[model samples]
Target: MNFSQLQCFVALAETGSFTEAAYAVDLTQSAVSHALAALESELGVTLLERNRKGVVAISNAGQKIIPHVRALLASEAAIEQEARAARGLNVGKLRLGSIESIVSPALLAGVLTSFRTAYPDIEVVLFEGAMHEVGEWIEQSIIDIGFVVLPARGVESTLITTDEMNVLVPYGHRLYDRAAVTLDELYEEGFIMEKTQCMFRLMKRFGFELNKDKPSIRYQASDSATILAMVREGLGITLVPRTMLPKKLEGVVALPLDPPQPLKIGLAVKAQQTALRGTTLFVQTALSWAHEHALLQTVSS
Candidate 1:
């Protein structure tokens, strides 16, 4: 019935948890419960149903109301969006950061161009760094937002893309012509670990040790370019996210792993940056561009 009630209702419906909804909307669980109860009472129907299995979902009657409720919320958001868009033209600045791998294939330039078209006055400053550096910047409030691999720390995120992990081998390597590479075959080769931490990150996703055998580490570098160069020279092979591979595969071939490991990427910001005008616009623009280009798919809600 009121703004807070609407917000709480949407949060509860989406999260399906009193505790999670409370945390999401920044309210006490009791407050969330009270607000939902009041709204249901006013509407003369129970929206959320619960049972003995500790289950919760939208009630039959609630399903009918949800569409209208969502429309109301969407209209309200449009009103606010218009105001923000107008003010965005007057003055704004956003500091953006990203792990280097996501830059080119993400078509980040399209996002930037769209954002600039939408808010010509807003200035976007970009910082490229390793995964840890980006996380550190977000935590320190050094950058307003960034593209981070999900299950990330220190920031809230909305998933934007998932790039598959691939094994990069030199042109004439024995496995170069293979469709896929197995973990055993991969670990046997000398690894040129890059600073991106792709192995450990994907390891966490798969819940396993990627380099369990202490595979020979022929080289390590902070940049993917250096690692790729080493790979080209037959020094060692490395795991590279598909998004990071060069358009022309002259030096290395990117082969999918037998059981594909996915790299989930998201547009992330410090919790406080969510309310920034420039940051909000950039996020919106990036998502819109990705969706239009068929460059995005959600890994999780």
Candidate 2:
């Protein structure tokens, strides 16, 4: 089948809806349907089930061929990349993903500057989400690379930096001036937490069985800044990565946990695909910049 037909098949298989697949491939719904129909007709097999309810399901034969199709697409992309490289053309598009907490404006700017300096013709697209979402994007091939916290599953990673977790308390709180605070001590206070998988993983790592003894969770927020604001307003105490806070604390105090919980940050990519040329160069540049600037001590996985 032609690449366009394969592309249509892949998009439809992944999205499971004609409209969404068309949007993904930047084609009209009619075009996408026509391409898929042509592919199925050529193969003499039903690849997708059609229904009046707008439901799309891959047939058993389609399921068996998905991996092969993905591999063919990847090989085609690699060939195109090599051809451009041989012609000395710095042309490529890289899709990157990162968690909001780790992607500060300064850091993001530095990365973009470095990448652009090396490959002016290349275009970079960025997507921001929570750590878990970033990982999901990588696994689904939605992004070429992602910045994720350590212990990421279903992908290979290269360590970029590491930061410690700190207990955040209100300025006038009893534990504000303490040298260090224990998890048990913090458990007694009201808690405001970000609704992130990393937070849950951190708790599990520290042997805090949330189901057995749930902390007094007063508020659940999606952003670290909002959680910090809630803590400053005397809503509750929370734990956050040290890198997430600013240098100066106004109405809050961040104390080192009695037993440090180090957060390891890394760049992750799909386990199945080797790094593309653009992706490899970008990762190297980012690592070098982080090392030269002493941004969050570099670490190894």
Candidate 3:
């Protein structure tokens, strides 16, 4: 099938809505429908099933074929990238994935700036989500490169920086003014929790396990700002990365763990063998920028 039909299939599979799929691919709804209809007719198989409310669900065949479709799209992009590269053109697209808690807000802006200046023709698209989502996107080839917390598994990674986990509590709390709080103390009466796999993995890295005696989690939040707001209201205490703190910590006391725990942040790709040339440069530029700005912590290279 033509790339137009394939693109239509992928966009519909991702957005699950014909209208949003059309918007994503810059096509009219009717055009997208026609393209998909042509594709299914040619394949002799149904790829998408639609409900009465217009939500699209992947049929069994679609589920099996979708991964190959994504890979085919990625291969097309890579081919286009190489054609431009052979012509001595500095043009390509870089898609990045990340979680909010680990990326340094200021340094990431600088990283983007340096990357843009170095490859002025390259288009950068960012997809921000939770850590697991970022990892999944990298593995699924949905993104060219992504930021991940090390020591991670199932992807190729280059260390960028090492960060420490911290705790935040409202003013006037007994532990608010402590020098540092221990993980045991914090989990003994577990507070509001940040919903990230990296946090638990970070603890696991430091010889702490939440499995034996699971901490009591009163509330869970995905956004760091919302977690801070929850703590500010004294709903419960929460732990977070220091880099995640906002410029102003008005009503919360941010404290480090007594035995400081380190979280390593890095860039990931599915594999270097399949990575685009631009993706390699983006990784190097990010490492260079981190070094130039003194953002590099424990991890080197």
The TM-scores, one per candidate, come to 0.63, 0.80, 0.89
- Global lDDT of each model? 0.74, 0.79, 0.84
Which residue runs of candidate 2 sit more than 4 Å off their true CA positions?
A: 12-24, 40-68, 102-105, 151-154, 271-273, 295-301
lDDT by residue (87-108, candidate 2, tens digit) is 9876777879988765555566
Q: 172-266 in candidate 1: lDDT tens per residue?
A: 89999999987767556778886566565565466545555656667778876788888999998887777678778877889998888777778
Arranged by lDDT with the best first, the candidates are 3, 2, 1
Q: Model 2, poorest ten-residue lDDT window? A: 292-301
Top-scoring candidate (TM-score): 3
lDDT, candidate 1, equals 0.74
Every candidate's CA RMSD: 13.7, 4.2, 3.3
- Candidate 1 lDDT for residue 120: 80
Clashing pairs in 2: none
